[model samples]
Target chain A: MGFLGYRRPDGSVGIRNYVAVMSSVSCANGVVNALSREMTEIKPIIHTEGCGRGLADIAISTRTLAGLGKNPNVAAILIVGLGCEFIKAPGLADQIKPSQKPVEFLVIQENGGTVKTTRKAIEICGKFLDYADSIKRTDCGWDKLTLGLECGGSDALSGVTANPVIGVAADWLAAQGGTVILAETTEMIGTENILARRAADPAMGEKIKSLIRKQEKLTKDILGPLAGLVISPGNIEGGLSTIQEKALGCIIKAGNSRINELVEYSAAPSKKGLVIMDSPGSDIFQLTGMAASGAQLTLFSTGRGTPAGFPIMPVLKISSNTELFRKMEDDLDLDAGQVLAGKSIEAVGKELVSLMEEVVNGKQTKAEINRQDLLAIHTVGPAF
Target chain B: MQEQINAVLIHPSDNVAVAIREIQPGEAILGLKQKISARQNIPRNHKVALVEISIGAKIIKYGETIGIAIQGIEPGDWVHTHNLKAEEI
Candidate 1:
């Protein structure tokens, strides 16, 4: 069954409708947090990388922050900033103006101080919440949904059970005209050829190859003797013997769908079906990038268990093994480990899809219940 | 007749299977058409060679080459970092 979602003026769909307060630079995070603490209706977007960075990181930060503001999940947004920071609140708010949502900006230095800026933010955000609350959820089709695929803290069962189960659902969603995003270029190592071959066209296939190739080389150059050459003793001890084996586990979450688009970090998909966003393998950065790309929800599987959720999007956690599922029952959403118990992959996938429906239809996941609102932006280069 | 499954064949084209539970030496490696007994103590979640693989052959799992076998691998041989080498970038 389809779910009820908030439709944006730009025709995008959102599973959640929240009034958000974001810090344009790290200096304003204190005020942003204070506003959220004072107003329970505001989802706070806090981060550490708004300034004191090279141009590359600034570009990434600006794009990511704008993407998060423009994300359909936020019905309204308030940007807070320090006047002297590289990424100012007005500039960031201007980038998100195309969304046609209620937007406001505050400068801590100009607004008197943290206390004064936060007071004004609370007033503006309170009005935004009122506007947000007036909107109602409408029926949305699968075509309006974009689900992101992610996996972290993995064990061997991640590939055999959780990721493959996610794959089946990913392919099913794509077949139904919904969008699925596969990210984390760091985990796409050694399987560049395999993934590229599934691209929508030869040119996109080449792009996929080069994107993964660049990540592989960077991994080697930066993590020499630590990555790319051999499985670490730690990895071997944990039962994985090769980089491909580890990487294969991650890529399976995309299923067999043809990758229709490849977007840069935090860029929105221009097509449906499966898309790959270039992001770090680090869990928080990938989650935030996918969220900023306008994914309404995420399908995150873990073998070792991670309680990571985005500020606005819902994260449905699936466990790779039955034991971990039992151990982390309160934290996980689905149990794919039944595949090892003789259940077929398709069966668990269907179950996962059903669970996904419930979550999208306003069911609170464990992460949401625990208020696991984590956010981070991927920085491509050194600071200062 | 049904056989007890102790390992999982991730893909039909795969030449190796991952043991769902530890397999003792001489125990039959399930999930393969040809009966292959574990040659040594195969750790849980570790790969077992379903077919005898000569050295330098591509090690297949999920129906793709994950790496290359550095040493000749017998059926039910435990594949790890020592014998399985990662593919070069």
Candidate 2:
């Protein structure tokens, strides 16, 4: 069955026809945020990057911002930049122009300051919103959909319940020809060989192995045997002493599918099947990376409960245990804890897919309803 | 009365099982041969060696080697950071 979606000029399918305003640099965040306040209809994406950084960070920020602007969920985008910044607003607008969407830019310095930029950006967004509203939604196939696989705040039940359920749903989407992205390099430390074996070709397998091995070496220096970001007193108490055991829980959400293509952080995948985006294990960074890569929606599972949602797309939260689901009833969307109560993963997965279909059909998830709009870009280097 | 399970063996080839709930010292691990009893207090969600493992042997869980035994481990002994060391690929 197809869901209603907006067909963009560049032939991309968008589940949400949102007009977005983003800051090209941290200095212009005030103007971008002002634009959002002036026109609440426009989604504002504010980040702390874009200026005074090394070449690697500049490239990463530029690529990530451009990617976010080109995402199919965004009908049009307005970039606000401090003129002196390394990553320019015009550059970001130019990069996103190929998407055939209405892309605009306002330099805070050139536009007389934050006040003028905010006023001008508001007017631009007003027109974009009107144009976005005029667009019509048509039935789009699942093949046009790309789903990001994410899990955080995990408990022991996460691997056995919610993750496995998410895995089944991921497999279902893959079978329907939809794209699924499995990120979180830090979580795949021990499973490098296993993931490598699942790759579609020898070269892809080697790439997968190398990517995970690199993460293992990088994170191993920080906390000894523990993978970065996942080492907590809770994790230690839960019997996850090694990176492999911890990562094994996270990779299950990718489901049992042949690895198709592996892309750099925030880069779009060229293949159709299950792809992997090289992203950090941190929730917000990874979520933004997936959004920048054009995932209209993401499936997130949590044991302790994380309420974060992307500004441009929907994030569906699944709770591992029934207690947490009940506690976070207003925040979480589904409960996979029924597996502990004798319900099968297949059944929960089918329910999750149904919810996904409803979401794609315009139904809002808990994250969307709560407006948990959070965004953070992953960086390779620190800002100067 | 129904038998209650205390630990979970995630894979057939795994020599370690995770304690689903805390098992006291000398308590028999459920779902296994009655001969094996907990050698020490196995905390909830912690690993318990299901078989004898010599030092430097790879510790298996979920059918993959997660770490190596830094010290000799016996059946029902709690295996954690103290006894296991994570290896780099």
Candidate 3:
């Protein structure tokens, strides 16, 4: 099957063509927001990771900034920075230069101040919008798609219906030669052995094991004793008792596909199929990593429901129960609750894939229409 | 879709069932041949013991060990943090 998408010069396909205005550091956020406000077509990537961070955090921030700019969904990028930030505007733009897309750099410190930089950004972004508008959607094969699989606000039905249903769709896309990224390393606590067992080889399996172990140790060091829960209190109220129960449900979103490789946060996949990314389980943070890793779209399963989306990509929200679906009708895109009411997973999976086709064809999701674009970078170390 | 469903046994091997609807005390859950009645008010999405569980026995839900019973749990008992604790992996 094929969907309408924007074909990038780097051979990547995008379902959205956005002119991105990104802040290299928190200091330039106001300018980035102001410029994006003037242009409705401009997507603002305002984040808080330009300075006062450890080396690990700086590296993560740099990679995340470069990846988002390089994402095929962004037709043009305008990076704004404060001249003295650790991550410079030019350095950030240079990282995305390989994408060969239109990239402009403006510094608030160098270009006078906020007002001048905003003016410069407005003029620059206007040009980007012109370039972005010229890009047309072309027919692209399903093979060009890279999907992000995610779950949040999980209930008991999440494991049985929503996650398993998304899993079925994930398997379908993988069979079509598409890439699927399974993130939230903390959610893989109990199910690491199960997932590792499905790895391509013994070494890959060991990598999966170590990733989970590392995540567990980090959480323990940060949160003290209750770190075993890994999940939030909301998850417990949703019927998940422990991390193991949540992990069992979480891993089902990957389907039964063989894991190809394990990647670091914001790192793009090396090959197509199922790839596990090391990232925290926070909904927005995970979405950021997935989007930066080149996922064209994200399929988010929820039982309690959430209205989170990315600036450039559409987040397809699926709910497992009819009550939550009715309650969050304005936010959710599809209902896999039918599986719990007796429909087959294959049927819901087919419906999900069909919905994906419509979304790629320019059908805006509830998150997109509502403009719930929340972006956050996953930083590991403390700021110093 | 069947309306007003009260509970769902996720897996055949699972020793607990999730309450799809709030199951009142003494309500007979369907699909179980033994005709077990809820011993107490079981909230929706919460677990109900399908079989008697001894102290320190694994509280199996989703066919996986979610926690272990800290006390003897009778069939139809509402299973939660009060009598169960998260298992160490």
Docking model 1 quality class: acceptable
lDDT for each of the candidates? 0.88, 0.87, 0.86
- In order of appearance, the predictions have TM-scores of 0.91, 0.84, 0.84
The digit string of per-residue lDDT tens for model 3 on A1-384 reads 588899888889989999898999998999888776777778899988989999989999899989999988999999999999999999999999999899989988889998898888888888888888899998898888889989988766888778877888898999999999999887787766667778999999999988888778877887896876567788788777777777877787877789998888988898899999998889999999999999989999998889889898899999988889999999999998876575556778899988988998899999999999899998877887
Highest DockQ model number: 1
Task: After the best TM-score superposition of candidate 2, give how far the Cα of residue A133 lies from its true spot, in angstroms.
Answer: 0.9
Which portions of model 3 show Cα errors greater than 4 Å?
Answer: A229-243, B1-89
lDDT of 3 at A254: 78
All candidates: DockQ: 0.46, 0.31, 0.31
Poorest lDDT segment (10 consecutive residues) of candidate 1 chain A? A225-234
In model 1, what are the clashing residue pairs, if there are any? Answer: none
lDDT of 2 by residue, A212-270 (tens): 87877788776676435555777787778876777777887988899999999999998
Clashing pairs in 2: none
How many angstroms is residue A15 displaced in model 1 relative to the true structure, after the best TM-score fit?
0.4
Please tell me which model should have the higher TM-score, number 1 or number 2. Answer: 1
Report the Cα interface RMSD of each model, rounded to 1 decimal: 2.1, 3.1, 2.9
Candidate 1 segments exceeding 4 Å error: A234-241, B1-5, B12-15, B26-41, B49-59, B67-89
RMSD of each: 2.9, 4.4, 4.2
